[model samples]
Target: AYEYTLKAEKVCEEGTQKQIPLYDHYFFSILICAEVFKLDSSFHDQAKKIAYKNLKNLKKVQTQMPKNFRSRYLLAKAVIKMNFSPNLKKEISFDFLSVIGVANEDNYLHIEGIACEIYGRFLKDKGIHLDGAHYLKRALGLYERWGANFKVQAIANEISNIQNDDFNKEININSFIEISESLSNERDLEVIFKNILETAITFSNSLKGAIFRRDHNQYFVISNVNNDISHYPQSIIDYAYNSNQIVRIDSIFDLEDFSKDKYFTNNQVRSLLALPLVANGEVESVLYLENSKVDKVFTADKTRILEIISTQMALSIKNAYLFKNLEKLVSERTEELEKKTHQLQISSGEKQTLIRVLCHDLANLLMSSRISFKRLNKKLKELELSDPDITRYLKKIDSSFTNQSHVIDNVRHLELAKEKGFQITLTTVDFLKTLTNSIDTFEQQISTKKINIVINENLNDIEVLSDELCLGVNILNNLISNAIKFTFEGGKISFGLQDDDQEYYYIYIKDSGIGMKDQMVRNMFQDNIHTSTRGTNSEPGSGFGLSIIKSYVNKMNGDISVTSKHKDDFPEESGTTFILKLKKAV
Candidate 1:
């Protein structure tokens, strides 16, 4: 094949041919196909047409073929290229695949390997993966062994591209995730700062490192693995602030050069490098590394690598620093929050105290006024024209007293909720028994309001770990009151119990009450926020009932959320649901 192909190669190379009929042979035609395609691809389709004309010629030469795998393999290669004519891959069959497999599995393992790789690539290109990723794996291994650098690189590039496609579809944690994750443990900023310095110096092969907070005017040796510890240099601490650049020197002589004129040699070392550690755009410190040994010089590569490492070290340390600042911010914010919360707590307590005083005191005052007015009314009636002006003043005084009492009632309700804030007393209480007890307590209110209450019998069986009286009564009272307030005359209020995957036995109290607006839901549990309106029938109570329910629910380490048909665009279906997820008993 070589001898015949070579003569043909020379003939084509010569570019001078007579008797075009003799030149159109299979061997010669293939050489033309290769040459034309190298020059330009359009010629191969032209050459394929010429190659097909000589198939019978290939059949005649099969008798002179060698017993080696080369002939069968080359034949397959020729036909495969031919097969590209008008898309012959679709016309191929099991037998055709077997032939290509044979070309790869035969003694021509070199060519065989390439064929197998190409087959796998064909499958991969068409998204036709076989069992266990067999084809692509085999192709990668075979191509690597074949010493085909370009082909190997191409396959790697494809796999990388596919991996990139997968990466592009993914949703990564944003910068805020890092911010929030840092915020979760923000109090230990100093420890994290020390860790950052220790990690950079130790792993980065620096002899020692330190952190100086410029704002605080304090410096601490964060990490040190110095060889000469007989004397610690204190002048170096002072000198670092004086020299600003990232300092790297080759020898003790170089240090002498910088020390004589550059004004940074006060804390001199034999061969030392220093880089500025920056955080939030300010020079926080100068990080220095020393090689006190006499023989070695820090190479350019070594210094640059150190510089890059320092840059990264600077960034990470800066991040921890920013993290510290954030911690300070959060601390300040949280302290301010606590101060406000405490003030609110105190104010809430005072309001509640005032409510209690108002409750008894104002009730007494109103009664006394009522009595005074009664006596005056009786006396005026007895007198014929009993000071008409005084009569009118009595009526005005009575009206003012009623309004004052109404205001005091609301104040008293807010005070009770503020003082009792979700009274949490954990005990293993029977869920059913406690719930039934709470229901029994509200029987008077239910009867007075003429609202029908329905409790499923199943609520009589479960046990829960909670402050049964405080938690149960608060939930039942708020939900039942809501139900009675919103439900029509004959509407039903129901309570149900169940277990959920969160390991909690739940007591759900849902009501047929008027639903709330979406915007009001967020502020529902926050104190000092007014987020209520009149009920369906204008029955007025301080909106402290639900707020009291929320306070208790939170103290129990449980959660309560309301689901209503509220929308941004439409009025709701006029019902609210209370879903209480409580920690279940063991």
Candidate 2:
């Protein structure tokens, strides 16, 4: 069938112009060929080549293929890889298990069944008869559900052959299955230790047993069952641990002065078996079982089974301890991160409060100085003597004082806005009247600079839903003051407003000024970057105006953006335009 499909695909690609169907046939043919080759040892080399080729093609077209098809292809490739490399069996097994998980999640029952069957066969060939039988039974159940009678029979036959080959091996397989299931299910170290102790007692046919675990080179009993014995003879446990060998005593009377040992004498132990659990050449734990009524109850076969169980138990317990410690470390680190985050918030609030206080104090001092200067100017005029140099110096001092006061006032407003989280009390604000007030505030500067202020006629009656007193006025005042400062003498500053679909009011402020560079414009509204630059007339600036304007605009649920070009780059096009979009008043 696979050869026929490949030939049909080739015919379609060459003659029929049906590319999609041809690709589908090609994918299925490769998949079927790989599976067919996997069943016979003589075809293993062919299977490996086809499987890898399929994997390469799947990678090229997986996104175009169905998810179930992709998962099945991966499973087939993993099976071939396992058969090809003996040294990579463990790695291939993990890959096979992962594919099984994804197949189960996707409810691809056919892929799940095939994966289980292949894994069972692999384990059986490796002499892991117990695990092999477990997987085979699972595959048998899946096949029965799907009504695949042939597959069910094949899997059941394999299981039967494994069981009938060795009777003692069957018992050990059952014990191992039970132990593996218990270890997989239980995570708590105490619970795991108790489960292992119970299984050990049952397998060794002992009346009572206890497991002592090593912690920091100290031995302590971690689990016990059906025994009132609190402590074991330290001498025997030490001998087994230090010698890295099993210590068994069939008859206590065989040793000289054995009655002097309190543990054996008091408990009347007839026979005892102690096995050391070693990992990486280090003794990690010891399993001690005692039979009070029977002599020589623990046989060599039972000891061997116990040895396997003890080795697996040691590794499981170590994993549980490591997991517990990892959880503790994660919790501690999370707590530390939360503490630092809270401290940062408090520090930010404190810094804002300090800025408000400092600005307020500076504003008060400036007001007093302005008043004293007014009186000093009046007295000088009364004296009827005016020196041009003295007059110019006094005017310069007054200008410096005025600029400093304006900067302080703006800073105080900004701090208040931040402290209240930019909260605005909404009110109907006449946009035209707000712009008029801002222009009036900067009238003296505009006149001094000989700047032409242009207002669009359409803005005469515009109104917006905003806080007119704090948010609206502050936003307009900052933008206009910036324009007046940056504009050269006799330059023009224009203001305009337009409504868009009755939803928002757009305001524009453009100025023919010594414009900013692209990098400067990008960082102007960010407080982290210091963007203060002198005006064309060498007038000082605080660099806080644009930041304050952005915050106020956001508070009113508005957006603001700027466009500019450096005068050195394009002298004729060198100017700035600030665009503000605000919600319309209803």
Candidate 3:
């Protein structure tokens, strides 16, 4: 079968076909060859080599295969390793048991049966007759479900042989199963340790028992059953933990120095059994059982059962501690995330409040400065024969004060809109008149930049329902100011208004200047984004114009959008257009 499978593998690999099925055939052939080689001593080395190769290949493709097939491959590899290698018995047993768990989880009945049968046979060969018989019976039941009559009969015959051979000293299979089930279900470390002690006392028929777990260099009694006695003496626990051996005191009176130990004097413990739980070459826990009334209550059979139980308990205790620590870490991280989120919200609120206060105070100071500049300019004009340079200097200072006052007012307007919401008093007004007034306000800046402003003829006499005095003027002023700032010298800026049948007006403001990039256009209207760009003549801007425009447009129940391209990139078609829409008055 191996030779034929190799032939098929070559055909599939060289032919125009899928290689997955060929790989599956190769994997199964290697498994069969390894099993065949295990029967003869001359081929044992070959079997080990084949098994190692199979394990490597299975791992390479395990994730790509189906769950059931992957589990089967793992079980086969573990079984082969167990059979061929005597030194790897402990490691192979863990791998075999892990595969059994996977088989049970994925409901792979055939694989589970195979794993149980192999493990049972292995245990029986190692002189663990009772454990082997228990697993063999379990496998027999599963095989019966699949109508495997030959396998059932074979396992039954093996069970009968074991029973007849050891009828005088029969093992309690039910008690072992019950202890395993109980330990598997328990998740808490303290609870599982207590359960282990309780199960150990019941199995051994001892009066009292206590479990001591080692943490770092310290050993503490974690669980106790039947706690009527006083201290059991830390020296006994330390002796078993440090020695890494079971301390069995069948008869305390037999020892001449028994009175020297404090545990014998303090308690009525006649017989004692302390079993150390060792894992990975380290002592993890110890099980101490005592019988006050009986001298030799713990027998060889009972001690053996306690050893098995202690081994399982050590692993469970370690897993439970790890799970508990993970839960604590997750809880602490969640609390920290919530605290950071709350702090961010508080910081944002404080920043908004500061902007409002600073803008309000700055607006007041600029207003007073403007008043004094106006009075000075009037007195200078009164002296018509005064120096022209003095008059010009005062005019430039006045212009600077006016520009600063406009910027502060815009900031204050934005703060009010954010704080009180965009609440507008809707009144019917001429759209053209409002737009013209907004343009007239920026006349100084427009002349300085030498830009031409054009109002479309169709926008004449248009009426809209808006806060024409304040909100309407502010929205138009922002858009026009931006257009003038960005437009090159002697560039044309056109404005137009159109109304749809749905009673909505569209105001278009197009500029012949440096157009904004795609990213700038995307973030232009966002209040949190600062999209500040220098003008054609290096004129400074506040970056708050678009945010204020968006707020006012939303207040008037309208929307705004822009389309632009950089003037340098496309000299002829390079410009920006601002489209503002509002509700047409009835």
Best by TM-score: 3
Q: Name model 3 segments beyond 4 Å from true.
A: 1-347, 350-354, 357-361, 373-410, 413-416, 419-422
Q: Write the per-residue lDDT of candidate 3 for residues 430-515, one digit (tens) a residue.
A: 98888876786676678878889888898977788888655445677778878888898899999886446577878789999989
Preferred candidate (lDDT higher): 1 or 3: 3
Ranking by TM-score: 3, 2, 1
Q: Candidate 1, after superposition: displacement of residue 181 in Å?
A: 59
Backbone clash pairs for candidate 2 read: none
Show pairs that collide, candidate 1: 104-112, 247-274, 422-552
lDDT on C-alpha atoms for all candidate structures: 0.52, 0.68, 0.68
Winner of 1 and 2 under TM-score: 2
How far off is residue 370 in model 2, in Å?
7.9
lDDT by residue for model 2 (1-586), tens: 6556556756876985644564455455555665666566776565456556656655555556657366666675676567566568788789888878888888877778888887887877787665666677667778888889998878766654554444234444334434433443344666777777766664454556777776676766764543332457666777787888897777766445335667665577767888998754677788888766556656666577567656556654544454455445544643553455455532556446656655655565556545545654564466453566556646655765665675666566676667667555888888888777668767668988999999889887777888876543568777888888899999999988644656887788999998999999998888644577789988656565688778878888888999998899989978999998988898
Displacement of the residue 414 alpha carbon in candidate 1, Å: 9.6
For model 1, how does the per-residue alpha-carbon lDDT over 1-586 read when each residue is reduced to its tens digit?
A: 4345546645654664423333334544554454455456656565555455444454444444533433443544444453454245554334335645665656454445544544555544455433112343444556677777677667545443332232221211122222322322344655644554553343223334555444455455444443232233434434555555555666666654345543344444545555565433556556655534321234455555444444434444444455456445545643454455455543565445534753675476456545544543564465343455555545655654564565455445644545654344688777667666556645545665566677777667566667765555556546666666765555557777644665775566666566667767776766565455666667544444567677667777777877664423334445666777777777
TM-score of 3: 0.36
